[model samples]
Target: MTNSKNTGLVPPSAFALGGDLNVTRIGYGAMRLADGPERPADPAAAAIWRPPADRAAALDVLRAAVEAGVNLIDTADAYALGANEELVAEALHPYAEGVAVATKIGVLRPAPDEWVPLGHPAYLRQQAELALRRLKVDRLDLLYLHRLDPAYPIAEQVGTLRRLQEEGKVRHIGLSEVTVDQVREARETAPIAAVQNLYNLATRGHEAVVDYAAEHGIAFVPFFPIAMGAHAGPDGPVAEVARQIGATPAQTALAWLLRRSDTIVPIPGTSSAAHLKENLAALELALSDEQFAALSALGQDEAADGVAA
Candidate 1:
């Protein structure tokens, strides 16, 4: 597999979000923009809380992604307790044509390193307004419910977002860390254009949701798309695949996701421009049938062996 058509960091293809807004399949996740200097234990935790990122560099990274032809930028108000949104606006507020900026709501950060979900209609509505202000956009390109609130019914959460849409504050709706059933039910309340879930080579708990999004024409945005921890070792399956494909382990993981489904859009976050370029290069990696299958089962072989035993 090879990424020869790398245009900046953007893939050479586009996906029609909700059948309207079009963006590149290889997007940029803005979570790392909120990361200070330390790498968290889990990539997921990196966005929950952190010291403010270096302002100038963060802005440069955002502009560079756009300059590279990457149009889909994912962010959230919960990131850095709202500073991330402000940073994005400061850097790309007068957004370029064909660029789609998406953000999420429903999660609250009370203290450093602590996060809680509040899906009450009032809270969600307030967050939408704040997000709109911070992004400096008339309407969000896509607004995702960051997480399901156990206290509120999924209907209520989606319905609140629907009202925001009706008010012309949101152009589309999305969900994160959701199930296939939840996605189905969410559509009953409002149109869901995308689903952001934790998925990668080793972690694949959202397999059903991933396939559902493909079948339904919903964009499946993979968060933490490069978290191939154990699989990153020199002797690991991912490493062997990378060696064969002539790509880095991270690129191999992302390429597998791209080959896994056309509807899949991987947003691998990074603060450095070099890492961002590497992630976007995965778009050109066209894995052969056999190579794709081998990488697909990289982390599942052990489970299959255990079952056979």
Candidate 2:
């Protein structure tokens, strides 16, 4: 279960987020780049969710992430209600070749603090266009429908995305927070490159979809990769394994995810250069089978809590 091959260097793996694109196993998430009420005005306060050390430092962190070989940058239209995308474009525009910026539509943030689903065909089309304009790209590398709208048929939503693809506005289609059956339904309309769902060591409600994506060559990008907090507390399995390997629990969680599936890409977000560097270093931590099993079991227990709820 141990990896003697570890020269204490991060393992290099490439994941195609859909299309001809390939990027390193660790990706960056820009959800914390916004200057708004949802995020902290001061970067140092934990109560202020998703705060950066400072504006200049936030930009530096992003630049450092890409310089460190993070090629996939995940953001959403609703994140900071479009501010995240703007920051990403500002930070990485004149973007390097092979760098992919994956943005999502379908979720609306009427206020900076509220999220509402607005996946009507017209809304979807409009948001995609807006994202294209904001990112200042002719074609979005990967465009995801942020969530499925129960008010409308899934086909209608997927059909709209397909039309965008046909028009050459979007290079690849993606889905977020979807079930396995929804993925099948979406693929019938257009090729799907990836799925972004809330997944981490403490949350695995979409393991079926993650497994299916791995089996079928679709990328599975996990958001909130380091949100386990107290669940991975001292003396916990994640902590125990982390201690044995000389890695932080957050890094251990990310390493376990990388070892879980080749298609799995963890986009851990941060607005600090130090934390961003630490998160990306997870690529270097090669987890053992024992560690993976223990973390997997912890996720299962957390899933049971959700089901019991």
Candidate 3:
């Protein structure tokens, strides 16, 4: 596998957290692999809500990612329910030694294409077991509580995961879409290896959480590294930087993320190999300090419509 330095692209600074896990700054998300409700033959039709593509080719894209040194793969139990886990298991089942598969449990799918929060302790434990069965793993490397259920005490949810850690069902515990106080509360129960939150150049409400995690040596995985839509508009900063760097606007956005923090792992999802490769290439595209400042200013610009960084 080619490290960032060897590829002649801007190399991501390495981060050491959760013991010996050395992951590339960029990770791949598997949410786009499912064949939707009908499990259609064509991936493009399967992902009608987004771009259309081939499902087999989607799997191939993941395989290529592994070969390209992306050791971390993120997924969730609610993504196509158990199908996404099954696809991940089948694609990387024999298991390359250092690859880390982090999955979440908390969201419940009662019917097709529907997601609901069900973070009750019993439901969480049950889904953890099911995710274990689907992924064909004895101990989940990293398990995240997909969401916090206000109906249940946060301590209760954290305690359930603590018990799982004690029982050897999970190796590391993480939380998603949580506040800084929630993280401190959960940590009192058990050590938190990471925090996955909705953070991007446009949506940075979680900046406090990111700073907190960094200070404490916990990984901060940003879920939508590239915000959806209009990034390449006529006057968009992303477009301006893209033109300067000889890369696409999306690539420039991802490059800014890589430079944001060593602890940040951006898991941008895509079903197309072409887009996947383009996203990875961002790891090598280094922005100058001025360029970083420009992008940062864009996030703060009122005219940019409150895009958070």
Please report, as a residue range, the 10-residue window in candidate 1 with the lowest summed lDDT: 3-12
Candidate lDDT scores, in order, read 0.84, 0.81, 0.79
For model 1, the superposed segments whose C-alpha errors exceed 4 Å read 1-12, 35-53, 301-309
Number of clashes recorded per candidate: 2, 1, 5
* Candidate 3, lDDT over the whole model: 0.79
- lDDT by residue (1-309, candidate 1, tens digit) is 454432223233678889998888889988778763266555556654653447789899999999887999999988888888888889897999998899999988765556789999999999999999999888999999999998999999999999999999999999999988889989999999999998888777788788899899999999988888787899988888777767999988888888788789888888889888888778777666777788787757543443344
Candidate 1, TM-score vs. the true structure? 0.90
Q: Write the per-residue lDDT of candidate 3 for residues 147-218, one digit (tens) a residue.
A: 988888888998999999999999899999888899999999899989999888877677778788888889
Best by TM-score: 1
Per-model TM against the reference: 0.90, 0.89, 0.86
Ranking by lDDT: 1, 2, 3
Residue 49 of model 3, lDDT score? 30
Model 3 spans > 4 angstroms off: 1-13, 38-55, 301-309
**What tens-digit string does per-residue lDDT give for candidate 2 at 1-309?**
224643333445777667478888889988767555545444442222333436677678778988888898888887766766877788889899988899999986555445578779999999999999889899998999998999999899999999999999999889999888899988888889999989888787888888899988999998988888666889788888887788888888888888888899989987777888888778778766666677788778766664454
RMSD of each: 4.3, 3.7, 4.8
lDDT of 1 at 233: 95
Cα shift from native, residue 145, model 2 (Å): 0.5
Task: Using lDDT, give the best candidate's number.
Answer: 1
